[model samples]
Target: MGSKQSVLQENGYTVMSEQHNTIMLKNKDGDQFIIKKLKADQNEASDFLQKLNHPHIVHHKEIIKDGDCLYLVMELCEGGDVSQKIKQTATFSEILDWTVKICMALKHLHDQQILHKNLQPKSLFFTACGTIRLGEFGVIHEWSSGAQITNPEALSYIAPEILKGEPYDEKS
Candidate 1:
């Protein structure tokens, strides 16, 4: 959209939150979404997300272009992210439950030959109903058979092999 104000009015969505380049919106139906604006040329991540489908993954609605910017509309997770939950004192059972959910999401991604290079608490979100869903595909990568990729920016959550400057497979 050209401007956040105009886009909100045109789409019938109210602003829930706003960031420098992104805004969270909610429609009259109570459906929530996150709209992110990026340079027109930066469509790789949005394109990839559009083709992805999984219960534990945030869903992509559509992409719209206004001038030189591309806007990505995606499902919103209202219960917040794992980082907030981690800050609270959680029971062992609760931790195990969340772990299992996250593992299932990772398994689904692997099945699709996708690698979530950044797998931290911030990337893990909770739905309004309390189900864990994986979000933030900004650093995702698709791998062909036997292909390896190098990524060292994830820090503590990154695999050691990546930090060592070695090409690592999806499992890394």
Candidate 2:
């Protein structure tokens, strides 16, 4: 968390932007990486990163720990997410375009048997060329039928069955 100074890299080091609990690295190849610290027993996070790989999802480049803080080096979405972009543009078409792309990404995940339980505007990244991509599937999962209940974050996108305290079909 110092003024853009040279930081550690593979075999060498590079200068990066330092945030509160995260660091943004500008790799020698001109690629930007957002590294953040991880809490203890983050096996779920580690598993999600290893299991899921999609074009719409942000890439997990590396995982490092400088001292006690664990760093998850991920591809930095330069233009920010859909919500941030929409805040600047009040047009319906812009919102539609972003939603379509985001929905497509969601459908893709569903096809892979993965549910992105947290599907908020902030989690949908937007590009300059008007594209919406999903990010942060750390809490994503492929649950089996007739499973026990848990995870309150998923309640927002819950289906009718779940609302009625019935077994939830994640694919639905």
Candidate 3:
């Protein structure tokens, strides 16, 4: 939406520790940017956000700290979330375009050893030019030791092995 001033005014109060909400802000030069505050102690989120380098994935600009709030500034996407466009497409071609983006995002995450426990349509924020970006790292879960991931994710996307009362490790 709106400019940095408006977004900050509305969302600034919630921009504190444990707040996962994303906001819009501007730099010293008046350049608009997107900022998502990751949870403190979430090393996996910090690591993933730092290593991300895909075009389809949101750009990882830099980490900033304002008092106690930790912010991750990223490239802004203007198409809004893909969930907003699904209902308007009456043609197969248009639908395919969105599908391709969704797949690309998944592929990018998997390739990077990161898994999004919440991979819903709403997570796919689209751009004005139809580019799709995978975000919302608050749902991202990964292994701290780079070992096999046997932990259950958010039940919605939890692996079958993890749902069967099997042994799972959070640091997998």
Candidate 3 weakest lDDT stretch, 10 residues: 11-20
Ranking by lDDT: 1, 3, 2
Model 3: runs farther than 4 Å from truth?
1-20, 66-68, 143-172
Q: What are the per-residue Cα lDDT tens digits for candidate 2 across 70-140?
A: 56777777778766776785589867766676677777767766666566666777544545568855456
In terms of TM-score, which candidate is stronger, 1 or 3? 1
Clashes of 2: 0
lDDT of 1 by residue, 1-172 (tens): 3685676657677888888777888878988899878777668767877887888888888887677887788888888898898888878898799899888888988887788878888889988998888887766777642223433444778788766767777679
Model 3, C-alpha of 160: deviation from truth (Å): 5.5
Q: So what's the TM-score on candidate 2?
A: 0.67
Winning model by TM-score: 1
Candidate 1: the clashing residue pairs are none
Give, for candidate 1, the lowest lDDT window spanning 10 residues. 144-153
Candidate 3 lDDT over 109-140, as tens digits, reads 77776666555666677666767787666657
Evaluated at residue 101, the lDDT of candidate 3 is: 72
Whole-model lDDT values for every prediction: 0.78, 0.62, 0.62
Worst 10 residues of 2 by lDDT: 2-11
